[model samples]
Every structure is written in C-alpha cells, then in structure tokens.
Target: MRPAAWLTWGALAFFMLNLAALVGAVLVNSFSTRWFGTWWPEGFTAAWYAEAWREYDLFDVLLVTLQVSLAVVVISVLIGVPTAYALARRNFPGKKLLSLLFLLPILMPPMTYGIPLATVLYKFHLAGSTAGVIVANLVPAVPFVVLTMTPFIEQIDTKIEAAARMCGARTSAVFLRVLAPLLVPGILAASILVLVRTVGMFELTFLTAGPDSQTLVVSLFYSVSAAGIRAQQTVDAMAVIYTASMLVLLVIALRFVNPTQLVTRLKDPAQ
Candidate 1:
C-alpha cells in the first residue's frame, strides 16, 4: 500500500480500537460486582441490571420514551407528508427559500434553538410535560420528515397520480389508494428515522421533560447526576440498557432503509 494509504488505514484502526475498548469497558463494568483498583472485577453479577431497572423506574421511563417517540413520529409524518407532496409537486414563488428554512432546524444544533423553544413552550404552560417534549422534538423532526420524504415523493413519477385522476378517482381516493401505496417505502423509512431520532434525542428532551414525562434518555441523565450516592454498576447498567435500546432501533432502521440513498437524497434534493 502507498504510504498515505497506510497512514489512513492506521488512523481508522486506532479510532475503531478506542471506540471498541470504551464500549467493552462499559459493558464489562455494567456486569461486574467489584473492580476497585483492579484490572477486572472480583466477581460478576447480573443483579445490578435488576437493581437499575427498579431503582430508576425504567419501566415507566421506557413507557414514556415509547409514547413520546411514537407521538412524534405520527405527528411529524402527518404534518410532513402533505407538505412534502406540495413541495415536490408545486412550483410556488420562494419555494427554494422555504426549503432552506426547513433545512435550518436540521442544520443548526438543537442547543441553538432549544432554549428559546423551551421558553415558548413554558410560556404556554406546556413545558415540563409530555406534550412539551413532543412539541420540542417535533421542531426538528417535522423538517427531517419533510427533507426525507421530499426526495421519495419526487422520485415517484407525477404521471402516476395524473393517471389515477384521469381514471375519475377523487383526490382522497387517489392519495389513499395510489399515492400512499407507492409511498409506503418512503413513509416507512421516514417514520423509522423519526423513531430513532426521537428515541435518542437528548437536548430537546432534557430541556422539556419533567419528572413524570421523562424519556429513557432524560431518565438516564438523571441516573447519573440526581444527587445520590448510587452504585456505579447500577448507573452502568442503565447506560447499557439505553445503548441497547438505541442499537435495536438502529438495527431495525437499517433493515428497511438504505443509508447511502438517504444521504444522496439529502445532498441532492433536486434528484
């Protein structure tokens, strides 16, 4: 191999090694009983997992996580799909500017808008509630669904919809029978992306979540810092569970969605 190529490969390997070592250490520590000043634990135990689940009230946390994630997905999709269809099919003035506006939320860091958005939610008495979390998450999620579904809608031939209309199909009938079936793959992909994003979203969720409305990610943060002399293993166990949940969602997402295609769509929306 060329010298530069060898150096690139070496750098990649080093980064992968560090990442693997970090995850491996966490996994081991989560299962270990005792490991003070030791290379490994004196004993291994699964009890910490149970303890973390009960002490953290993770069952309720997971439930909240699911409820919030699903709500965000449903709402984002409903609001996004029609908007995407309009943007994809119509040629209105300032369309590019509107598209760029949609891109802004995704392009900017959540922290940039999260504070102001949270303030607005709180002003409306929605903050520290499940509705607030959903609304906060929806800020970015709706745009994401728009960007994701836009390409899918565009790739679809408009002639098909026209032909359906030519068959005397009503607007709702064409959308429900023809467009929706054709859009299934795109809808599924967008929904899965929204699901994963909402599940793992920390900044917005953290800013808006309350005691009863906490998602798994918010609850995990509390487990780390909520004024306690808690067992490290228990915290590690919770982290493991959080990691596992994200990984499962990612795996399911990858099964149906092509990352390369999504990236291409994002980079070249005109296509």
Candidate 2:
C-alpha cells in the first residue's frame, strides 16, 4: 500500500481510538459507584441511571424529543419534497440563487441564525413552546430535505412523467403513482436524516424550547451546564442514555436506508 494510504489508516485508527476511549470513559463513569485517582471505580452500579432518569424527568424529555423530531420530519418532507421536485425539474431564472439560499442553513452554523429565528418565533408567541421548537428545527431541516431529495428527483427520467401524462393521468395521479414510488428511498433517507438531525439539534432547540418543550439534547445540555451540586455520575448516565438513543435510531434507520450509498448518490447523482 502507498505511504499516503498508510498515513490515512493510521489517522483514522488514532481518531477512532480516542473516540472510543472517551465514550468508554463516559459509559464506565455512568455505571461507577466511586472513583478517585484510580483506573477503576470502587464499585459498579445502575443506580446512577435510575437517579438521572427520575431527577431529570427523562421520560417527558424523551417524549418531547420524539414529538419534535417526528414533527420536523413530517413537515420538512411535506414542504421539501415538492420544492425539491420543482428545483430538480425546472430551469427558471434565479434558480441558482434560490438553491444557494436553501444551502445556506445547512452550510452555516445554526447559532448565526438561531437567535433571530427565536426572536421571530417569540413575536408570534411560538417561541418557548413545542411548536416553536419544531418550526425552528424546520428552518434547516426543510433545506436539507430539499438538497437530499433533489438529487433523487434529478435521477428519475422525465419521460416517465410524460408517459403517465400520455396515459390520461392527472398530475397528482402521476406524482402519486409514478414519482412517489421511485422517490421512496430518497424520502426515507431524507426523513431519517432530518429526524436524527432534529433530535441532536441543540442550539436551535435551546434557543427556542421552553421547559415543557426541551428535547433530550437540550435537556442534557442544561443538566451539564446548570449550576448545582448535581452528581457527575448522574450527568454521565444522562449522556449515556442520549448516546444509546441515537445509536438505536441510527441502527433502525440504517436497516432501511444505506447512508453510505445515500451520500454517494447525493454527491454524484449521475450514478
């Protein structure tokens, strides 16, 4: 193998080693009873997980996270898929500019726009609420759906639509019968990505969510950052829970959508 290839493998190994160590440390700490200047804790226990769940009201937070994620996924798909179809098929003037605008949210840091977005939501009395959290997440999520689905839409032959039209099918029927089935993979891919993104989204959720609307990630942030004499083990337990949830979600999503292939197609739609 080439020296460059060896270096790339070495770097990836080093990164993964560190990542595993960090996550392992957190996992151990979450289950640890006590540790001071030792490689291992004095005892192992599951008490911290129970404590964190009860103390943080994790059930409600997880429910809120689920609600916000599903809402964002559904809304983003409903709005984005059609917009993606239009962008994929049309050749209007300013189309490039419009596409660029959609890319901005995904490319830019959420903090840059989240504050103003929260402010606007506040004016409409949507901020600090579950609906506000959904809307704030949608700002970036809809664009992501648009970008992910656009490539899928572009890959389909226009002649398929024409054939359906020639068969006396209405536009809606053509879309439902022809395009929708073909676009299933793209829709699933986009929805799963958006759902994951929304669940893990912190800045926008933090900026917009209220007590009742805080998602798991935002709630975790508060638990870590809040001033108190909270147990470190409990916090670690919370982190572990959040990590486990994400892993489960990814596993379920990947069962239906191959992320590697999805990304490859997005990068080179002509394939």
Candidate 3:
C-alpha cells in the first residue's frame, strides 16, 4: 500500500484497539469480585449486576426512559410528517430560511442552546418533569424527522396523489390509503432513529430531568457520582446495562433502515 494509505490503516487499527480494550476492561470489571493492583480480579461474580439494578432503582429508570422516548417519538412524528409534506410540495417565500432555522438545533451543540431552553421550560414550570424532557428532546428531533422524511416525500411522484383525487378520494383518504403506505419505510426509519437519539440524549435530559423523571443515562450518571462511597463494580454493571440497551436499540434500528440511504437522503434531498 501507499505510505499515506498505510498510515491511515495503522491509525484506524490503533483507535479500534483502544476502544475494544476499554470496553473489554469495563465488561470484566463489572463481573469481577475484587481487583486491587492486580491484572485481573481475584474472583468472578454476577451479584454486582443484581445489586446495581436494585440500588439504582433501574427498573423505574428504564420505565421513565421508555415513557419519555415513546412520547418524543410520537410527538415529533406527528408534527414532522405534515410539516415535511408541506415543505416538500409547496413553494413559499422564506422556505429556505425556514429550513435553515430547522437545521440550527441539529447543527449546534446541545450545550450551546440547552441551558437557555431549560430556563424557558423552568420559567413555565415544566422543567424537572417528563413534559420538559420531551419538549427539550423535540427541539432537535422534529427537525431530524422533517429532514429525513422530506426526501422520501419528494421522491414520490405527485401524479399518484392527483390520480387518487380524480378517483373521488378525499385528502385524508388519499393520504391514508396512498401516501402512507409508500411513506411507511421512511416513517419507520425516522421514528427508530429518533427513539435511539432520545434514549441516548444526555445533555438535554440531564438539564431537565428530576429525581422521578430520570432516564437510564441520567441514572447511570448518578450511580457513579452520587454522594456516598459505592462499589465500583456496581457502577460498572450499570454502565454495561446502559451500553447493552443502546446496542439493542441500534441493532433493531439497523435491521429496518440502511444508514447509507438515510445519510444520502439527508445530504441530497433533491434526489
């Protein structure tokens, strides 16, 4: 291989090795019973997993995570689909500017705007609540759905809709019977992506979440740093659970959506 190509491969391999080693160490530590100045633990045990689950109140955390994630997905999709249809079909003044506005949340880091957004939510007495988390997550998610679905909507021929109208179909009937089926793949892809994003979202969730409204990510953070002297094994076990949950969601998402296609759709919406 060329010198530059060889260097690139070497760097990639080094990065992958470091990542794998870190993950492997965490996995082992989570299952180990004791390890102090040793290469490995003196004994192995599965009890830490159970201890972490109970002590962290992870069942409730997981429940809150699901509730918040599902709410965000439903609300983002409802607001996004019709908005995407309008943007795809209509030509209005300031359309490009409006689209740029939509892109702002996704383009900027959450920390940049999250504090101000959280302040607004708190001002309205919504912060530290489930509704606040959903609203905070939606700031980016709605735009994501719009961007992802617009290309799908545009790729579809409008002539089909015109024909449906000619057949005496009402607008709602045409949308439900004709457009929805064709849009299913796009909708499913967007919803799953949003679901994963919301579940893994840390900044916004951390800023808005309260004791009762904490998601798994927020709960995991607390497990590591909340006051008392806790077992490192327990914290590692929670980390493993969080990683496993995200991996499962991503796997399910990849089963239905091609990442390359999703990327292409976003980059070249005209296509």
Candidate 4:
C-alpha cells in the first residue's frame, strides 16, 4: 500500500477508536450499578436499564418524540417539495434573495432566531404547545428539506414534465404521478435528515414547549443537569435506548436511500 493511503487508513482507525471510546463511556455509565471512578464499576448490572424505563415512563417520551417528528416531516414535505421543484425548474426576479432567505435560518446560529420565534409563538398563544414546537422547528427543517431535495429535482429532465403536460396531465398530476415517484430517493434522504434534526432539536423545543410539550431531548437535558447522580445514570440508560433507535432508523432509511449518495460523494482523493 502507498504511504499516503496508509496514513489515511491510520487516521480513519484513530477516528473509529475515539468514537468507540465515547460510546463505551455511555454504555458503562448506563449499565453501571455504582461506577464511582474506582477503575470501572465493582460490578455491573441491568438495574439502570429497568430503573430508567420503569420509573420514568420511557415509552411516553418516545411517543411524544415520534409524534412531533412525524408532524414536522409531513408539514415540511408538503411545503418544501413544491418550492424545491420551483427552485430547480424555474428562474425569476429575486430568486437569489428568495433562496438565501430560505437558507438563512440554517446559516444563522439557533440562539439568534429562537428569541424572536419564541416571542411570536407566545403572542399567538402557541408557545409550549405541539403546534408551537412544530412551527418553530420548521424554521430550520423547511430549508434543509429544500436544500436536500433540490439537487435530486434538478437531476430530473424537464422533457419528462413537458411530455406529461402535453398528454393532458395537469401540473398537479404531473407532480403527483410523474415527478413524485422519481424523487423517492431524494425524499427518503430528506425525511431521514429532517427526522433526525427534529428528534434531536432542543433549543427550539426548550423555548417553545411546555411541561407536557417537552421533547425527549429536553427531558434528557433536564435529567442530566437538574436531576442528581442516580437520575443522571438513569438518563444515560434512556439515552442508550434512544441511540439504538436512531441507529435502527438510519439502517431502515439507508435500505431505501444509500447514505453514501445521500451524504457526500465518495471519491478517489489522489485523483
């Protein structure tokens, strides 16, 4: 093997090692009966796993997480798909500005936008409610949906749409029956990205959701910082479960849309 390739492989090995270390810490903490820094827990137990779920209503929190994530996915797709099609298919005045406007939220730090969004939701009596959280979360998600889907839409040929239109297909029909299925890979990729973002979003949820409206991420945050040590360990156990679920979702999503294509193109670096 070439020296450069060997170096690259070594770097990848180091990265995987660090990742393993971080994950190992989480697992140990989650399963540790009393890991008080005496060089590993004197004994490990499944007590934390049972305690976390049985005591804290883990399934309820997961329900909230799934509901919010699904809502965000549906609403974002409905709004974003058409806009992505327009952006990919047409040109108009202020197009650049309009595109930038959609992208600004993702570019700006969360704190910058959250304050104003909170105030708006409060005025509308939506704060701390599911609607409030969903809308606030949409600020970033819609832009991401557009960005991720636009490239796939662009990859499609305009001639196909033109033919459909000539064959007595309405614009909506062309979109529904013609362009929609073709964009499945893009939609799948976009859905997974947005769902992950929604599941992990805390800043917007913290500002917008109330006690019952709080997301799993917010619950985890409070569990870690506000609750004491046992609660912390229990939270780690819950996090372990959540991480496993995320991995499952990724695996399921990748089965439909290749993540390598969804993420970045793998290339020969030396080329």
Write candidate 1's Cα lDDT for 173-269 as tens digits: 9999999999999999999999999999999999998899999888888888963688888989999999998999999999999889779879954
lDDT preference between candidates 3 and 4, better one = 3
TM-score for each candidate, following the candidate numbering: 0.96, 0.93, 0.95, 0.88
What lDDT tens digits, residue by residue, belong to model 2 across residues 74-176?
Answer: 9999999999999999999999889889888988899999988989999999999999999999999999999888888998999999999999999899989
TM-score leader: 1
List, residue by residue over 184-253, the lDDT tens digit for candidate 4: 8788778888998888888998899887777788877777776765656788898898789878877877
* Model 2, backbone clash pairs (residues 3+ apart or across chains), number: 0
Of 1 and 3, the candidate ahead on lDDT is 1
Compared with the true structure, the alpha-carbon lDDT of candidate 1 equals 0.92
Comparison by TM-score, 3 against 4, better one: 3
- The candidate, 1 or 3, that scores higher on TM-score is 1
Best by lDDT: 1
lDDT of 2 at 23: 92
What's the C-alpha lDDT at position 160 in model 2? Answer: 93
Ranking by lDDT: 1, 3, 2, 4
TM-score of 3: 0.95
| Per-residue lDDT of candidate 3, residues 1-271 (tens digit) | 8999999999999999999999999999999989878898899999999999899898999999999999999999999999999999999999998888878888889999999999999999999999899899999999999998887899999999999999999989999999999999899999999999999999999999889999999888887787268888999999999999899999999999988877877894332
Cand. 2 TM to true fold: 0.93
Clash count in backbone of candidate 1 = 0
What TM-score does structure 4 among the candidates reach?
0.88
